[model samples]
Target: MEMTDLRLVVATGALAAVAAAGAVAVWRRRPRPGVPLRAGAVLLAELLLVTAVALVVNRAEGFYPTWAALAQDGTTAHRPPATPGRLDATIRRLAADPDLPIAVPWRPPSLAASPGGGATVAVPAGYLRHPSWRYPAVLVLSSPADGWTDARMLTAARQDAPTAVVVAVRAAPDLDPGVLATGMPLDLQRDLRVTGHRWGLVASDHVRRSARDVAGRDPGRFPAPVIAAGPGPSGLATGLRAVAGQLPAPLAAPAPVLAPSAAAHQVGRHRPPAHGPVSGIGLRHGP
Candidate 1:
């Protein structure tokens, strides 16, 4: 049974009750019970009761939501480390800032059993301060060739689309947009606080060239496609030909999404070529 199941809690409680009844019977059977017999009965009852209480607590509070988490020894389990597992490491840093945005590379497990290209999640600042606040989110689609780092995608979202969460998608040029449109967003919503019903899309010209037909066909998922016209251009062009009518908030009506643009910045020390060049990604739109 899953750890959170109510049935498990009920079953454990019932077993504890049975154990207590058995202990009482053993104690009352003889006016003078031997120390060993009484002790053994009492111990069994205590064990069952303690186990029941633990189950109840675990049910109420998700200490170990899954068995995998409970068994996960925070050691060198030799699992693939989270991509870009370290700091953004910009050249402009004089002092460390604790309030920097959080980024976590996520592989939707549903993709193999469910197909999905890996994506990096960029959580905005103040996400923790307001538990009830849910932010709009966007997916910035670019290939490895574009050199779009997770950090760059996050920066674009913060500066241009300040009101929305952003996910830098590392996807193949030919991969089905359906894989992203249906499953990817759902998986993201399941894990993060962002609204997943619909998402705004940011596509590089290279990616749009190949997947535009498929992506444009699904306005329900990708309501607005903001084109990133190469790295040198300072402005972003809106792709509305495929997206019929004005889209919803974070896309068109409520707050039209500004094309994400970025200023050139320096990286202190990037990963070696063996790990892939850390430089070059996104439309290098001028300040």
Candidate 2:
């Protein structure tokens, strides 16, 4: 069974409960060989309890994403990296498969200086449903200490717009805005349908200056960033577009084509990557 499987944790906990009950029953009855029977039951219960706790913690935190990670110091991801040049090919193959979404570990060399190594693109909800559609993209730049989890980003993606793709990354003091403005989209363009050259940005107050620098590096590409303060946002994007805890509204039109303008461009003339991502990472609802 997978180490992070919730079913295994529940089953082990149930067995521990049964063993504990057996120990209690044995003590009350004081049956023949009472000491040994109670001791054996108690020991079994303790072992099972410990096992259950370990499984629960592993599942919750993903300490060891797989058996290989456990053998090592957990540096490896749950999935293996694609072959050097076959990365794009692998992405295309998976893109054809019917999957809800993809959130692979994106650690390209160009943006190595950025905090958190790299950022993961949180694909929009009902992504597979609109196979022909390309999404409006947003880069959510949080401070290094923001603790922006994948689950939280997923929630923000859903809130932002069921159609808008969200990229969550932490901004470091020394991070190069020019590299972020240039490299990340290129890397993502390989796997995602962020068709238009431009992208919207959402930044927390702590990273406001960094966000501005990123936006200024490429005015046509980055545009004005929405400066958000804590849960409440107050910045350039005004009125309905700047809704709190969500991304700006992509369109004022009645129709729901998130990227109507970018529709003309063919996603940098590349096919979309598989929504399921490569073999290593499975789609999870929460972090």
Q: Could you tell me every candidate's TM-score relative to the true structure?
A: 0.45, 0.48
Candidate 1 residue 50 C-alpha distance from true site, Å: 52
Q: lDDT score, residue 153, model 1?
A: 62
Evaluate model 1: give its lDDT: 0.50
Q: What Cα-based lDDT does every candidate model obtain?
A: 0.50, 0.55
Q: 169-235 in candidate 1: lDDT tens per residue?
A: 7567556554554344445554555543345676766677534543443454465567776652232
Which ten residues in a row are the worst by lDDT in model 2?
Answer: 251-260
Model 1 lDDT-worst window of ten: 259-268
| TM-score of predicted structure 1 | 0.45
Question: What's model 2's lDDT at 100?
Answer: 49
Candidate 1 wrong stretches, greater than 4 Å: 1-99, 111-117, 209-214, 231-287
